[model samples]
Target: MRPATVFLLSALIIGSLEAKPNIKNFFSKHFFKDVYGTIDANIKVGDAGKPLILTDLIQQDQIDEAQAAAEVKLDAFLGVKSYAGYLTVDEIYDSNLFFWFFPSQSNFEKDPVILWLQGGPGSPSEYGLFNENGPFFIKDNKLVLRNSSWTTSNSVLYIDQPAGTGFSFTNGGYAENQTKVGEDLYKAIYQFFQLFPNLQPNEFFIAGESYAGKYIPAAAYTILKKNPSDEIKINLKGLAIGNGLTDPKYQVMYADYLIQHGFIDPKSRDALKDFEKQVVESMNNEDWDQASNQIDVELNTINGLTGLSSLYNYLENYSDESDDGIGNLLSREDVRRAIHVGNTDYGDSAVYSYLSSDIPKSVAPLVAELLEHYRILIFNGQLDIMVAYPMTVDYLQNLDFVSAEEYKNAERRKWRYGSDVAGYIKSAGNLTEVLVRNAGHMVPADQPEWALDLINKFTKNNL
Candidate 1:
């Protein structure tokens, strides 16, 4: 209930997120969103023609003078401003990133800002926006207000990154590694701040799920490297990764998880043993492509062994594709025009394929270094089979940080939401790992109330 009073990248380019991040993953789809829509139904905000800007609005006379002399008329939203547009990152490549900015519904000046990145390396942030955490959900092709949107108390910027995800586009070569991805993202972020200097003072954080586990660290490391520069100074703070795929090394506990969850017996576990060895051996051999491929193969094998159990959530018989119906919503001509993407195309398989080779490589070193300074929030759904249990715990318990040992031994305190034991959290120094009960890969979608509370508490250091 407490509003954030504080709140990515700066430079030439910005921002997929994926499912499972093992090559398939999502939500934290928002690594992951932007656009103008309704929150409470009484609002007619952020029409492109009268875009609500973040400048000193109280100075109406000044605004009049600016408007009178303005070359380009802009759109405006009510209360806190909301904007959706494209920011060009690469001139030679003609890469432009699309973004949706929804200001804090509670305290625009105080609440922190968040950049949500959904995983899939290719999953549109729109999946997270409309399907999960953003202010509204698209239902029956209508924008329905989501009361628990994180934007209720904090500004959230959702971007379609790396030019090819969502509405982003580029004629240049696709990014093939974390370094290239970081470069484009940093530039786009720089332009974002350049375009909106008023938000420079707010505390900012980067968050995503699934493959964004890799993207988040890449983005953060690039930002931290640029903090001392004068070109752009983002008031960078913390990070959050939901069911991320940071290190593929310790994350080779697939069959163990399946066995513990009762999805497969020891005999079936034995069947996957050879595949597990291949994954580890491939990773050790530095054949990242093969490693990722083996992991995906292992997962498919598991699915075959255990039919009808969703990879996103074991409790559900159907796989959770957060982007279901999302494309339909975005395909509407009015919707495209509303978001300012004029005749542009949506996402495709290219981004996923572009990142496939980069998938199995470990970003654990970057994560460890990041934990030394910024606070890192690691969370997972109890029912998620994608970035399943033990894998997250395996890496968390082994991180080389100031509080690594303390984190190892720290008591998992019971976390409650309205008298219900919602989850268990273990915290020490800059790292905190939470396991949400009855949830899956897309925590925000499965448990919006808990999702909102998490961002509020984590950003405020109240968790």
Candidate 2:
């Protein structure tokens, strides 16, 4: 029998005789399919934490009723599946950790695990699971299979983390800074590996996008420092970051470059240029709100466009007049559909709301948590102006590295994933930076093939 099955059976046999009648009936009726085998039985506990296992003598009818209620609750969510479950960890102030297991195709043994973190200091992993890199995509307004899902090649764990994002939450007192975020993530990683002792330490890689640039690296650094040597380590492979926010200065600098190169309009160029300067001054003076306001202005201007032609036309053609005009590339409907935002929505509020909402918020803390032990990959889409390629490139160019030449050489090499898209690589110690071409801020949405290829190469050390 499988180890999990064996463990479950032992627990059942030990508790069967003492099990209460109500509890026995409950498991027999409600948890048959949900429980894998004889070893897998649900044991409810009283306030004192005593197991209330079900007995063989319980009527099957009562079990059926209980199981039906559970199925209803589980099916209410988008990605509910057979192996779904929850674990409540009270050691960390009564927080609960929810997980979904995407078992490997055939193997029951310990497999490679990819813990996916979403971007946004506030976005939820559900967006990544359903809308972005998960095994499925929304099509015709329905969820459909994605052939290129990363999980087909590895086990993926989508965590709704921290205390306030997704289903993971605390009644009060959540950590917001890098240090605390890293600590919480470390606890989660430790517990996960502990629960699945068979998972090879070396087969794990940390992956996330956008703001994760900051979170992932910091966490990896912390893990490395704590581990020190390879033998005692988690065998972390590397990290993959998509359209991340690594450095404020570089992002601003590149924004200026993109605008000047015709990727954005002259009016955008003028506005952003002023905004950039103001941001630098604000940063220098430690005036974060002032700097943020400048970005908000630029974002509001971009948000005001109403049609697809207006959106893509501006992207394809750069001019001050073009900024105020609409074209044929994308209609207003197209923009609304692509972003999942509504018509008549303007300003950075939409993007900011998404970022600030419960969805992408956990990412910042998780990234801070994972940085110490794994290699880091910061990937970006070239066409995404909000997190522009030039901005990513600029941020990368400024990282303080141990070997300047190796880093410089890596950056100088032209990045090529396919026939037409162009990119470059920057390697500093274990961290690798990859920029995708002809892609937007959402790399997977714009250039999935290239994004997948880049991930494969980076993880395999082929790039």
Candidate 3:
């Protein structure tokens, strides 16, 4: 094998716990530029003089001083208590994941803790915070409160994962697969609980969008399998995914979906169908990169033929505007100091590199496993051609879950936000699917009230 390929393989192998330091060092030097920072295993002590942490289910001896010392005051915007900082993923060459958390507005003890992840594999959860369900958004370089933010009823946590997204960074390398990513998250979360033990007992729910469809399941499975038997178990209630790209191979049925919805003519539909056949064939042959390329080509062709606007939401026009104004705000020295991420770049290449790699396949099994222990809420914004509603339905129907048939034939009722018709929901057993109306790929950003309702219901096990 070529030197570069071997180096990547070596890095992957050494990411494991069993790998010796010397071998890890060799790969770190060859593959990753050393990150310039102090390794701070910042562990706060309790009255007993012991590290005030939970069970040793997670290996967190290498916690770095990524914790923000800045006292972030968001009372003017959110009128709620918030925390932002980084937690280093151990033994993996500068793999530090950053997190921003908001305590529940109603009652911290009474409300569930919801962990939100963003897609792109490399995408930062801060986008979800500012652009979606967080307490506030950045508008014209200032904080604007989002009244329907999920934090109204749930303690929300947003994490930038895989060591290179958003505020998170790595000098070693990015995570290559779902399993390793899960390990890093599991450990980081455990350490997060160590810092604030009070939140540990609150019921926990994991949710995300797009690529997070693959991540949420793996991370949840890791928590389930790896939690120390005698230690305090995370009160994991359920999992939710919105417009997620769970089964990429099957979810590539976007062309058929669009055609069914009358976006393309019969001839054009048939042509795209033929192209889709080729894409599926490529996937069957395990040429994932080729299959991805084929889908992109097909989708772009359809967009051209139909004159469709945004793939994220067909009902709207696409705009690359920095209207949100988060970049400028986060880059400010005062803001960084207040948030304790002093001088750290908000978004970086380490994140995108991780997303460019081959994705882990068939997370349906992990979803199935979670169903046995907790309920699963899968929803989509109907207008999202990217990871559209039909694609999510297609994958859910194919899962090997016990009540697949019941769910398939279940009645889809009209879901509501007060008197307004928000969307539709079909549920059976532990699986529930909702078709969010008039929303896009980022449902929370498009329909914040509806999105907040969804979370409140899911976290409470009401839906």
Candidate 4:
């Protein structure tokens, strides 16, 4: 984490009628200077310990104008009587750092913090927060609750990071490589810890899906390395990647395997196989465009079959717009809704969203950013052809870890969960790969119970 200079100043009293509070707010008169700059000070209060109070030096006009605009927007976005508060971090370059906090049933002190990362190199974590992975799932224009949210088991923190994605940026001058991303993320985590200083040190684990195969590992490595040697070491437990794209070479090879194994049509198989060879040869010749073109053809073939099912009945309510009768057949509403292209509001939209979102605009070119610092778990749904199990398996196959033998057994073995079948390989202390049965690209979305169980077991033993 980047270090910030701290200054202790005298606390300014607000009013005579109110009690002396540990924290107080003040606005500056400067307009063109930094959006928020703080001079930290030790302030005395009743029983709150000598707390650190950060004074925000912002122009009054700026605060009034921003507050006015926010009030109007909040009236519509929140739809009810609303409360607003602000905190100014001296080190964050952005002037506006806004967030919405909804009341949750779990106690903040008791629950573990679950920081969710959504893969995109450009997409926001909000997609996972409100829909697939977070606490609530919306249905029929109303919020229909979910029983087993990862947040229910842990306190969830959905961050829109790297400066320009979702609600976390200004002017869009974000990091373009994994090193910068890892560094920036460390800053965010450190600041978060300072703000919520009471949180347990070792209860956090980094997690994400899709391109996060890259983002999560990079950030986790940064956190682990930066942790203080004393105290509890911040745990830095383990990482979880769902339907991720960690390595380009393995991804292509896996697509070829899926095709050859009859998971996809013959045309797709042949096209992917031929393209795989071309991509490999192009890489050898350093012809990136040729390799990319071949890969594009393979991907397009897979993308074209978005809603057509290889496992279930094709004519059985194939429309993605509404899940009238599809819920009974599928495990998740997002999966059922994603069965058709028009239901692009949730998971269906993530495919195109990532390809176009801002994170990708900043992070994709920095692929080799954090390879040495983290232990990564790349998981995929066996039924998902987009970022198929073969793709994940292929990526892991090429990783040059010296402890590879320790992470996996000498021979392959089969593991069963209920009615599902998966191949298991463990590398002692480093990695483990187990395919979930009947699961698609979004493993949690397809089989939440199995996903959670796998995660719990993996973290308890590996981290």
Each model's lDDT: 0.70, 0.48, 0.70, 0.46
Better of 1 and 4 by lDDT: 1
Cα lDDT for residue 308, model 3?
A: 59
lDDT per residue for candidate 2 within 1-463, as digits (tens), equals 5444533443343244234312212222111011101111011221222211111111233444322222212221244331222334334555444444454442435445777776555444555665456666656444577766666556777664544554344444354455555566655665555445566553777777766665566556556666574333566777787766656655644345654655555544564455466556656675554444434433433333211122212354322221111111112343223222122112111222323212112233333334333566777776665566666665555545443456667644677655664677766666576766676655765666666677667667777
Find the number of clashing residue pairs for candidate 4. Answer: 12
Clashing pairs in 3: 40-64
- Give the residue spans of candidate 1 off by over 4 A: 1-81, 319-324
- Per-candidate TM-scores read 0.83, 0.64, 0.82, 0.62
TM-score of 3: 0.82
User: For residues 1-463, what per-residue lDDT tens digits would candidate 3 score against the true structure?
Assistant: 5444533443343233133312212222100111111112121221212111212322443223222331356444445577776676765486677787788888988789889988775666777887899888876667887889898888888888867777777786677778888888897777777766677788899999888888898889998897766265777888899887778667877557876888865656566666677767767887665554454455555555656556778888765433336665565555554555655655544654554434425678888888888788999998888788887888888988888899989998999889999999999888999999999888998998899888888887777
List model 4 lDDT by residue over 1-463, tens digit each.
1111100010111121024211111222111011011111111122221111121312232444433322312211223211122223324554222232222235556555656676655455655654565555656544445665665456555655545443344333455566666766665555445445566453676777766776776677667667865333455656767776666666656345555655555544554555466557656665554454444434433434332433111122222223322222222333222211111111222222223222212222222233334444556676655456766665565555654554444455565556765435444344556666667655666677676666655555532
The candidate, 2 or 3, that scores higher on lDDT is 3
- RMSD per candidate (Å) reads 10.9, 19.9, 11.0, 19.6
Residue-by-residue lDDT tens digits, candidate 1, 237-289: 89999988888787656778788878777766665664576677778888786
Q: Candidate 2: misplaced stretches above 4 Å? A: 1-93, 106-111, 140-142, 228-233, 253-255, 263-271, 302-374, 411-429
Candidate 3 — which residues are off by over 4 angstroms? 1-71, 74-79, 228-230, 321-324, 357-360
